[model samples]
Target: MKTLLVFEYRRGKLTEANLELFSFAAALGAQTAGVLIGAETLLPAYPGKLYLGDIVKCKDYNPEVHADIIMQAAQKEDPDYIVFIHSSYGWDLAPRVAARLKAAQVSEITGVSEGKFETGCCNGKMRRLVRPATTKAVLTIQEGAFCFTGEAEGTPAVEKLEPSADGAGLEFAGYEEPEKREVDLAKAEVIVSAGRGIGKKENVPAIAELAKSLKGELGASRPVVDAGWVDHNRQVGATGQIVSPKLYVACGISGAIQHLTGMRNSEFIVAVNKDKEAPISEVADVMVIADVMPFVAALTEKLKQ
Candidate 1:
């Protein structure tokens, strides 16, 4: 069955989630097609036939405009499935598209089997949760859910289809660049994440030391973000950056569903929480039940030595 894949290119590069989605769509017996809503110049190489259309331009992301463009593509392709990566942009646009098309909607998908989607949530601040149902549906695959493969036997043919210049009354105002930081969590090979168990803002130094020793990025749960212990970009959860690093060491995180939904796909998950029964422990490849500060200090010293 043909599947329409919605991908956005930013700053002249395809988003990582789109690459993962393309890899997944290939495995699901779907002939992939591409869609984008920006300057066509931004998209370098699309794997499959391109749905050539000029989306309504806005200074920043406009869900109304984005949803309209996707729905417009859906009418033309009428493919068996539509997919997105459950990122901030996807969450904004997916539900609207699903509602307009009267199609099933699935987000934060971890796996797919027999056309049924499996999903879970993970955030350190809240309790665990699971999505109980799945359907032959429109899905926003979780960022780390699928391992992306850039290799293809032959470069997929690229064709651009015309889209009429009509959408909700929205026009491009201008552009602004987001602030840059020293650490890019998305590319971090190792991450040291702090949770409520990390105690106070003062305790974060221990974790930071550990991260420095390990040459890793420092991450935080939503509470730490809300507490202003770190920059919002440093938070890792449903609302934060979804990271799939080679090694993720979560300290004092209880493994809320929203949080887990983000990082459960890591290659190796190592968590240190006092509660062994904490939901995070269930998915952890290595679990250590201990106090956050002492563990961090000890681990930092051991690594340094």
Candidate 2:
């Protein structure tokens, strides 16, 4: 099988999601080529063919122009699958390209099972494997689902494509910065996350103390955030921030798949919950089967010493 990866560039640098595409392609055992609708100078080092469309005429993120450029590359590559990262750029451009090509489109694929793509359904409460009915398909991969550890080998053979720059009624507007947040969990080296099993709001401070003693940031599961025990900024789950801390301490978390999707990539996980069979234990390096409150208190006190 052959795959065409549509890479995105922003703010003068290429997004890291481009590397993850290679990992996904390797998992699928497919031959790969890529397209970048940005400056040729920003072209990544790849082992395969790369189609570059200069950003000057294309203008940063004109969906119509970007899709046109991708379509041109796809025509030459004739890939079975055209893949994109599930981000604001992909969410807009992938559909436009898919509609033009009349290909099947899948979004936010988390895994591959037996040559089928696995995507979350019903707000991530369930998972379903899918195969496109059409011979050609468009796909978007969820960020952080695939980790790329390998280094690039061999220089990519570069091909330049001319962009038509027909924006199709849409005007190119200046980019706006996202609203600033109180915390950026993605940068945290260590995170101690509270779950519903942490009990009442009063017990949250103990968990915070544990995090502070460990010199880590405080994180919370959806339930803890929903209950107002913590701010939404500290939420670590599908509906919140995705984090891959060096050390993650999940306290009293039952480990819903939604929650796991956010932090399962942590380098080392330590979970403290009363239930040994809790889903969180599956991903944890250390699963402490104990009550949440007393265990947290003891651990915090010991850390202080």
Which 10 consecutive positions of candidate 1 have the poorest summed lDDT? 123-132
| Decoy 1 TM-score against native | 0.72
Instruction: Give candidate 1's error at residue 153 in angstroms.
Output: 7.2
Q: What is the lDDT of residue 45 in candidate 2?
A: 77
Highest lDDT scorer: 2
Give the per-residue lDDT digits (tens) of candidate 2, residues 1-305: 99999988977889887899999998889999999988876677787899999876787768898998999999999999999998878878999999999988998898987667999665454678899888899999988778899986677889999986589688788877645669999999999999999889999999999999989999999988988999989999866888999999999998876698799999999999998778787689999999999999999989988
CA lDDT, candidate 1, residue 54: 49
Per-residue lDDT of candidate 1, residues 213-277 (tens digit)? 88998998888889898788788877678889999999998987668867887899999999888
Worst 10 residues of 2 by lDDT: 120-129
- Can you give the lDDT of residue 155 in candidate 2? 77
**How many clashes would you count in candidate 1?**
12
